[model samples]
Target: MIKKLSKKLSVSLSKSLDGNNEDVEIWTYGLELLLNGTIKFGLIAGLSAILGTFKPTFLILITFAAFRCFGGGVHFSTYPRCLTFGVIKFLILGSISNVKGNMFNYNLLFYVTLFLGILTIIKWVPGDTEIKPIKNKEDRKKQKVKTTIVLILWIIIVQILIRLNSFKYILPITLGALTSFIFITPLGYWFITSIDNILDKTKVKYGEVK
Candidate 1:
């Protein structure tokens, strides 16, 4: 549905603007990206409404954005797979964020998460994929350094939050850090590869690729 909508939008724009085929194709691709992103965000928002987890989910989104901005990660090959992975990821992070007071030590979790997250970033950071490789050495260096700084800043902020007894925020922040770290590892790249394989098999049986 999102793909069809995007295509229709691009076609409408092209006709109205008297665009050529190349221009229309570019517009179609951009519209697909816009629509796909909106649909995925909508899915998360709907889930939050049903689960009453808006705050935690929002925190998870913020933390995910912080590290992902510089750390980078695998991107799904197709929109459907991307949406599927995103929904699952946010669901788990949201669940973690909703854990009640004193069930587990939030402070301890924060410390552990910070350690692991920084270690992962330092060890295999600037992780790239076959389709979206980070090839420049200078670019790689900058990303790694920036990703490390983000993680460190996150730790400091979490510490301040803990001092303020903002226990509710700890879980989501820790989960976000962990998720971000995972993305900068080979595990994250393999996930995309796995998704690609699934898409390929389904396409083979259906005799078409979306």
Candidate 2:
């Protein structure tokens, strides 16, 4: 449904703007992202309201998305699978923040996440796609620098939150950063590919991947 809508909108807009085939493709991709983001985050916000995890969910979403923008991550083949699984994953992380108590040194966990995040950014950032590969070395370096800046800002934010006696906020940021970092790693690609294959089989069996 979203795919069709995006195509229709893209076609209409392209015609209105006297755009060619390339414009249509670009518009389609952009519209799909906008529509998918709206629907996915709308569902997440609604669920968070019911579960009383709005802040945590919002934090996780923001941090994950920031990292994802600069550090390209693996995407599911279909939007439906991405939306479904993405919501579940974020909701679970947000809900986990609700459980009170220190679980084995959050400071240690934060530093460890920071260390791994920096390493991942240096090694495999701009983990580009076939559609939008970062072919230029300069572009790849810029993306890595941007990702490192975001990681640093996230670390500072989490640390400040801790100092302000707002401990609950730390978990979601850490989880979000860690999860996004995984997507840039070889292991993360393997993990996502495995999940994608599983979902593909399931969709074939169920006839749901339109």
Candidate 3:
């Protein structure tokens, strides 16, 4: 469906804008991204309404999506799994925040996890997928810089939300930050690879997948 829409848009752009194949390809790719984002966000919003965890879900989506976009960590190879994983992810975070409410673990576990996240970012970032692999030194450096800036900004935002000292903000924002941090780690990379492998098996069983 998305491909067809992109194709139609590309054809229209070609006629209206008098564009070439490269221009058409650019517009088609842009349309695919726009469509995919719309669907994903729509699903997220629908789930938020059903779960009654709007704020938390929104925060989780924002932080997680931001990291996943620039951090360039693990991503599901297929579109279906990506959507599934994203929904499951925000739902879990939102559910936990709703149930647990304002919680404090001002202990070593919190500090340890935060430190681990920092280490992971320093070591594994800016992570890229196999398809959108960052091959150029300049591009790689730029991505890394952006990743660092975003992570720092996220940390600052989380701290500010934490200071709010409200379950509504603190719990959701803190947990969302934690989840985002973990997703950029080697473990996240492992999980992505595992999912891809399982999808590979599924495709084989189905035979000649679309």
Candidate 4:
């Protein structure tokens, strides 16, 4: 539905503006990405609010953006699957963080997460896909540096929060950071690709049945 809508809108706009086939294609792709992101984020926010986990969910998303902005990650084959998977993943993070408060050592978790995150960024920061490869060596270097800086800043901020007795925020922030860094690791790539393949096979089987 989103793909069809994007194509229709792009074609209509192209017709109105005398755009060529190439322009329409470009517009369609861009619009599809924009629409998918907007809808996915909206659904996540709405569901989090309804589930009474909005604060933790919002923090997780914010932390995700902070790290992911500098560290590129894997992409799914389809918009619907991406949206579905992301919504469920973040919701789980939020719910777990909310319910697991003070049950374990948050300080230990924070240190472990920070350590793993730094090592992952050092090894695979600016991870790229076939569709968006970072071929430039300088660009890759810059991304790694920026990601490291962000991780450092996160460490400082989390420490401050801890000193202030804001323990409730610790787990969500750590989870978010951990999730973002995972996307750049070998295991992360394999995991996401396996999911995409499974979903694709399922769709094919359903179509055959129909």
Candidate 5:
């Protein structure tokens, strides 16, 4: 049953990537992202479940997805890249927890992991070796401020969610976060990239390549 579902999902996603129908493509893209994210989070949740820390698993997944929606989406613009990062991050978190002998304090480890991940993202910023002028200085400043505000809001919400033991609402929260992150970040990138490739091929076939 799972395999059948996965096959159908793949076909649907491929059709969406074709980008012939805008509305249907957008909806399909959203579903693709959600499914991919859910699978990734499910893997982490399974690992946590094995270690008897299921609640934190769901919480961590939500927090990670929220952050990805805001930041990592622009940094790693590929579904495979995002999945790779997710797997690496989970391994690092698990290894550090093992070394510290504190599985219950996974939240602390998650924060540390996120901090390091942010630093990594910054290090990979485009044009790091070259200086570029802001095309619209005022607009750039406003965007920076907005991004900061959104980040602060996200942090506060995460804190409240943790305190309220929202992790206990595991399945739904996981699904929501997973769905949002997938569309807004990795899977969205994949959809765009696939369309670009198809367009490039079509242009070439018509002798319109530049």
Candidate 6:
């Protein structure tokens, strides 16, 4: 049963990556990915919803922006971006909670954090042999600047949310921010490694790297 499920999921993911479906169809596929059985994704989504509960529209926009900036390929796909953002957001929120002496609601935070950490370790343990070295210094620098600016903007937004006494909505907003940070941090590294692996495998299979 587990094998069958895994195979099914793998096929779905591959199809989504292949971009064979219509735009709307592809978007639905991405949504399925985000909504699938993943604790990290759930926590991030839940937290985002909760934080933006008072202002759901803004919360959604924030979530979308975080996913687009931190997680790659946000234009037509959403699932992967959401999952990536969720894991990253949770990690950041968890860290902030620890530092600020705030007793966070542990039920979701703890489990998601643990799950992501474990997955990261497993993914990296074989030594990230798949990561492609960055060859373009200018592109790398541009990316760095863009990332830094986005992060700064996120921080400012969070502060504004807090000032507005969005305390009741803190969980979701914090989760969103944390998820964004995670995407740029460890989760981001994992994503890069995964992409490199895919590209390398494709090259080997097709006799050329695109």
lDDT of 6 by residue, 31-147 (tens): 554546355545655664565432432453465355344233211022354356445544444444333223355335534633543442233221211223334556555545554
Q: For candidate 3, which ten residues in a row score worst on lDDT?
A: 101-110
Instruction: Rate residue 168 of model 1 by lDDT.
Output: 88
TM-score to native of every candidate shown: 0.80, 0.91, 0.87, 0.87, 0.43, 0.36
| Candidate 4 lDDT, 1-210, residue by residue in tens | 888999999999999999999999999999998998899889999999999999999999999989888898887876667778899999999999886556358877887888888888878889899888998999999999999998999999888888898888888888899899888888899999998887778879876310
Whole-model lDDT, candidate 2?
0.87
Candidate no. 6 TM-score: 0.36
Candidate 5 per-residue lDDT, tens place, 92-199, comes to 444333333232554663365445443433432111111223345454445345434544565566567667865433323333333333333444457645655665
In candidate 1 the C-alpha lDDT for residue 16 amounts to: 97
Model 3: per-residue lDDT, tens digit, 1-210?
887899898989899989999988889989998998899989988988888887788877786677667767777877778888888888887887776532455324346546765786677767777777877878777777876777678667666656785546655656665676676788878887887797788789987432
Candidate 6 regions off by >4 Å?
1-61, 67-134, 186-210
Give the clash total for candidate 3. 1
Per-candidate clashes come to 0, 0, 1, 0, 0, 6
Alpha-carbon lDDT of model 5 = 0.49
Worst 10 residues of 4 by lDDT: 201-210
How do the residues 117-202 of candidate 1 rate in per-residue lDDT, one tens digit apiece?
86777677776767568889899889989988888788788878878988888888778878877777788778777878877998
Q: After TM-score superposition, what is the CA distance of residue 91 in candidate 5 from its true location, in Å?
A: 4.0
Candidate 3 — which pairs collide? 72-127
Reference-based lDDT, each prediction: 0.80, 0.87, 0.74, 0.87, 0.49, 0.47
Q: Please give the lDDT score at residue 18 for candidate 2.
A: 100
Question: Where's the lowest-lDDT run of ten residues in candidate 2?
Answer: 97-106
Residue pairs with backbone overlap in model 4: none
Q: Whose TM-score is greatest here?
A: 2
Model 4 alpha-carbon miss at residue 59, Å: 0.7
